[model samples]
Target: MPDHASESSVRPETPEPTGTSKPSRATESKPEGEPTERPESSEAPGMSEAPEFRDAVPSPPQVPAYAQQGRQPQPPNPWQSNRQTTGTLARLRPARPAAIRNATLWAAVATALLSALLLGDGLGPNLLIVAVPAALAAYFAAQAAGRRLRTWSAVWAVGGLALLAVPALRDAGWPTFLAVVSAVALGSLTLHGSRSWLGVFLGSVGLLSSVAGGLRWGMGGVRDRMTGSRGRWGVVFRSTVVAIGLLIVFGALFASADAAFADVLGNLIPDVSLGDAPWRIFLFAVGLVGALTAAYTAAAPVRWDDITIRAGKPRGRLEWALPLIVLNLLFAVFIAIQLTVLLGGYDKVMAETHLSYSAYARQGFWQLLWATLLTLLVIALALRWAPRGQSRDRTLVRTVLGALCLLTLVVVASALRRMGLYVDAYGLTRLRISVAAIELWLGVVLILIMAAGMFGARILPRAVAASAAATVLAFGLVSPDGLIAEQNVQRYRSRHTIDIDYLRGLSADAVPALDSLPEPLRSCALKEIQQTLRTSDAPWYATSWGEVRARDILEKRSANALVANCRGQGSEGGSGRNGVEGDDSYDPY
Candidate 1:
């Protein structure tokens, strides 16, 4: 026997036992490049089974300890796995700061108190007193919420404040109502960081959301604070309770000790009666909800401009351009007719149509207004579906839409001219003046759209909004009732007739113009307004400039005696119809 173990260790690639010895199946199936294994022969050396020989065989790679123990790896804990993700979100978007919460809370309280003290009686200077402080408080609260007052935001804020002045300047119900609505819209835009028209609408939605969810959001913050540090919150609560108790005890004693002090206290504090509690609470709740809504919106403003609306699928050139071209031709035809009627052919057209000037104007004015509005819609839709793959497509869109805008402006002008004719024929009324102003404003908007086509539309939405606001402000400043009264008075001077009943229904804003009328007519026109002024007992803070002027005019002219003496003055030729009643025959709607 040779030293088989030594030989095997030295030459692991040696051939297996030959002849009678059979090789194992593993050795027989082994590839040619692999080393041969030892044969199980009795005469084979026992040292071949030693650790050194066995160690020469290769093994698989090591596995995890758990796998080695014949068990699968344990699943991760779901709660622990989400810790990092939640931590990241918390770090990225923290809650509103305590300072902002406190400031806004105080603002709500102040707004509530001011509302109870200065509002709810009537519309006047007191509106300004209440609105200005509330707006300023909201502005400062927004600043605390980390909103920088940029130029646009500042413009909106200032515009809102200016609109609030309408009540102080004029006493007409419609103008004051419009001012309040516009002011609220602008305030929403300012608080929610909206600059586009779509953003304006979305900001309105955000305002409603804030109103609906603001209380819950505030309570969430309170819950967090109370739960985060109980000891600190408990101490604060006890301190607040003790402070209130001490204040009540000391304040009652001081108030009773001196009559002057009691009077001063009475003046400083609101009179809170059990009977009036519900109304006062309702007013305070309204103010609180408004202030809190603003504060909540400012703290976490929605980026409304970031919302994108996908455009309609673009059409082929012929498909998109054909309808617009036909519409443009129609618009051209209408413009040609309008021009024909406007130029020296008005008499011929009116004669052929068998209609008076007023009838012609009234019949066509409303239709033209609708046409103008629909043309705008058509242009918008055309632009949305216009072909957009080539420069020629862009040129076509600009041409068609621009032509449509220009034609719509002509229609607006026609409407306004017809309104002028109607007003000339039958004097001015609130409806006529308001419609004319709207037509003029629409014309301005069309001009803006045309300019936008030349340049870019990035500023178009805000410009339109600003123009609307400016229109409203200018309308208020000019005093619509006063203008109507003045125009009617001038018409009366020329025609030697007046609608005394129509003028009598006017607000105090028309006092000066009505006061200029001839004796009996003036007395008839000012009768209702004079009685109103005498009966009103609004506080000084709630008195408007229009009211003050009306009172002064009435006192100087001794309008009471004139109105008393004017009995059956209408039959004395001071009041008569200048033309057919325009409102009954012509429905502008």
Candidate 2:
């Protein structure tokens, strides 16, 4: 051992033996993956005694334990995140925040401008046509800039355009214009990928227009959506043949019983109000639309024929029972009508000479026929096109109700005309307008009840019952002959006696109310007031009635009211009394 130690000391002390020996506590205190410790002489003066351990081999500050475990600190995100970062972030983050903020600010400015324009009077109507388009362009631009782009603005814009287009749709070249638009819309649906919204918009437009056109065509040229595949020629030819056959049958019946059926169809079909040339043009346009719809429904890309078409003939009990039930109902209706006519019911129920029970009965026959055909067409279409097991009962019920409404309208029209109110062809009378106002109120209630029914079906039994109740309430409350109705001048004159002198001294608000009273009553009231105002001989007050009346006129806020009074020259009030003897047609002003 002495000889080996002497050799080791002389042989340049082998580094392998020194390294393999256990390190001292001071050297072991440093961690692995660090540089070897330096000599004590290199240390600063009194470093060990100064209570400071200045590290010669320093490592970066150690990460906290929580951070190492990933329990507190987290990886950095390119987007916003509550995390620590050890690397660079995404470049897009900075720009996106500013872009979103700017886009939102622009949207706010546009909305405010739009609101201001709409609130103004002349600007609103003049700009209304272009307002929707301008608004839509701004909305779309902003939406694309925003995080999520909603496509609903596009739908609204198209709807607004349709409303504006209605008045201009009856032009001489309108048919060609419509056809072009329809074709464009239909073709747009074929677009793929990013252009899909364009297709949806165009298709929706075409569909809405088609619905309106179909209604204007009435029942004669209605299309079968499910059977559109057979082509236009086949459908048109079939319709023509049916129309001819019916006309021939009608002619033969008329020849046999001219007296009975002469007046039946006379009123149902109105004469050409716009002259023959225009009427023919109208018919041709209507026919074109009908033909186009039929062709499209028959052969559209979306196959609807498969569901409707049945390869085999029906052999079920339904076929037999349905015809029998229909026959029984027709027979029952005929019997009821005959019985009523024999019991002097016509005399009792008839309201006007123009529109009578006999007229309604005549109209009902054709209406019922048209309605049945329409319902059958809807049923056939639904059966063929709808998914299996989806019933057409709802549609059929709706059609039946529509027929009832038509008949009810005619009956109500006659009743109104009998009460001395002027009614137009579509039953648009002052009484009807009054009823409509009341009906509008009832409609609000109907909506509430319908909403409640969605939650629990027991809220309302049937919509029909509500409709009938509404009609009855309207008839009872708003009818020209109703107990409290102000339609009759005589009733008003008999009820309230207007003090002419007192009214003449009142303000413009009270003067305008005279117009609200029945015409004859207004005439009498104004007459007495004028006599009091114009004459000073028997007057209670000592003032020029004209000066007093002019003062009353100046108090009016309405420009029209002011103009009407100014035109009256304060003598028109007396004219209501002395303009004519007992005639009620004098100016009520």
What TM-score goes with each of the models? 0.75, 0.24
* CA shift of 90, model 2, Å: 29
Put down candidate 1 lDDT per residue, 4-33, tens digits, no spaces.
Answer: 878877875856543334556876798899
Candidate 1, after superposition: displacement of residue 73 in Å? 19
Q: How many clashes in candidate 2? A: 3
Each candidate's clash count: 0, 3
Query: How much does candidate 2 score in TM-score?
Result: 0.24
After superposition on all C-alphas, the RMSD of every candidate to the true structure, in Å, is: 8.9, 26.9
Candidate 2 lDDT over 513-543, as tens digits, reads 4445544434433443444334422111112
Name the weakest run of 10 consecutive residues (lDDT summed) in model 1.
570-579
Off by over 4 Å in 1: 1-100, 219-276, 561-589
Q: What's the distance in Å from true for residue 221, model 1?
A: 5.5
